[model samples]
Target: MSSTISRSLAGRKARRRRSRVHSLAIDGNDCMRQDNIVVEIPTSTARAATMTSSSDPIPSLGQHVDFRQRFEEEINTFATSLVHREPKYVPSHQEDALAMARIDSSCETAIDHWMLAQSFGCVKATDLTEGAIELCQLLVGVDGCEETRKVLETLSAHESVSPKNFLRGLCAGAITRWVYLDTKPQLPSVCQYPQSDVLRSVLAATPNIYRRLVDAMTLEYLERHFATTIPALSKELTKRLHTILTNFRGLKSANTLTDLSDHINNFRVWERYMADAFEGALRLRLNHLRSPMKYNYTFPSSGQPFVEDKMISLYSEASRRRPHQVWLCLSPLIESWNESMDSSSHVIISPARVISS
Candidate 1:
């Protein structure tokens, strides 16, 4: 019985030692002790075991959920920071004024080229003058009146005022009247708005922004304005043209009553072209400006001394070298002011094209 009890005790002790060895293997120590002997784990075996434990598969969907949560948290934090930030610096009016000074020369050149092309394609000189004269006669209800004859004589006497130039001058005058005089009252009062001061400062700082705003506003205004004025433009222009032709020199007319008139007619093909060109050019000019700027076209009268700074001669370089007077304005000068009422801030975008005598 004693021998059996001693064997059982020895077996229990061996089992405990084996258990300790198994625990050490599970823990993956590089070296372990068993029965006072150091046992080293094989390098390859230890590496494999380490890789096996680390290579446990994580579900792709779980990883995606965790990534999405982190991303959303970051975005929210960024948005909150922006919301709590202070106001950014607003540009000063003086800065805006400087921006306005930097004109777009390319756009100005393009406008000049476009105007020349359109004018070149206009109605023949004789046809346009004849139609204009006929239209003028019909409107005045007389044929070859003293005023008409005198105006024609005056125009003829000026060697530089050719029939073509006469007609062109009328067209130019008509555009000036239509834009500056006739439509002035109807234009929207941009300055009257509550936020106009803020708007002005902002727009001044960025001229391009003002230009875009002006373009959009002008587009909207033109759509409404043209709808009402297009049908009336031809007659209104004819009247104004006749007035310019007859009254530029302050000539008086004898209102002679004529017999029943057989002259009822619409504008001829070239007349229509003239009106369309006028509208297109006017639209282009109106859309070119920045907001809150006041603009006008300079229409120099006949016999005015030519100022080299304001007027460009259609004459050749050799012809322009001589002293001369402005015989007629082929195209009006375009000038603008930074402030609506401030004449001191005047800027000339384009010089007037003229014929010199």
Candidate 2:
């Protein structure tokens, strides 16, 4: 298995080397293009309000109703655009719908997504700071866009005051959700996931400034999350790790960086241990065969027309498994479980089987 993975890695490296020349252009991936980006323009509230309502002296009931409906509709449209950051669908007229259709230029869209989320108070300043830092690094890497260089410089200054951008980048890179996939532990491979791939490349290629920024942001993040939780009184007199990590004073900040790195290493070790333990448990626990629902065992279920239905049923557990089949196949069959009482009610859906079998 190690050999196989190594060979795969080698092949990927070879391919990347071949394409390196072609990829020299800044913003090589269309995904990072920032051209034609649209920002959320704050319009005058008075103009919008006037357009929605009417100035009338004791308006008739029909006019009042029409005005009220139009006003509500306009409000809904504005709210929808702000919330979703996309053009809303209009069901009334095809012409109106066609007119609303806007070409989504990629560069413009990426910036818009990042900026629009920040404008409506959906994202915190810290979060924006983190994003801007990442954008700056990205722009520096691409090295082609003069416009992006200016933006990066501006963001760099802002990042010093607020560690938000740095925080955001650290969170996405470290606290990832793609740990396990389909009841199986995922291999630590950038090629397997887009997020991992980008993160690996960025860290490898970024300047020392960004690297130091990452370390600083991570230390601050650890301080915020863990510093206050540890109790002061302790008989062992070993140390309050969180406090030591957070404190920047002579006694406190001295070993803070090393302490944080140790904590992070410990967490990584724990994650690996847990993954291995789970895999072992899955292989050895045959009692899980009878408790399919508990383990989330799933299998293809029969549907209408017999042949057409390929959906896997969560409620119904497969009675038998092939000799070579792993326990992961017998675990919970559904992607996500519904919380309804009907779905939650436990019944002897699958026949009980011997654990030894």
For all predicted structures, in order, the TM-scores are 0.40, 0.17
Regions of model 2 farther than 4 Å from truth: 1-57, 66-68, 83-332, 335-356
lDDT of 1 by residue, 1-357 (tens): 999999999999989977767655555435434445344354465456533343432322212356545644554443334222222333334543332222222223323432332222222223335445553333222466565454455644566655455555656655655553445425566585454674476466655554544444444555556534645664465455534343332212432343112111112333345445545544434343324566666677655788888878885325727636766666667666765567788777667777776
Writing each residue's lDDT as its tens digit, candidate 2 over 142-198 gives: 333454455444433442212333222221111111111222322234344333443
Error of 2 at 350 (Å): 16
| TM-score, cand. 2 | 0.17
The candidate scoring highest on TM-score is: 1
RMSD of model 1, in Å? 19.6
lDDT for model 2, on a 0 to 1 scale?
0.29
Superposed model 1: Cα runs more than 4 Å off: 1-154, 185-268, 285-290, 316-320, 340-345
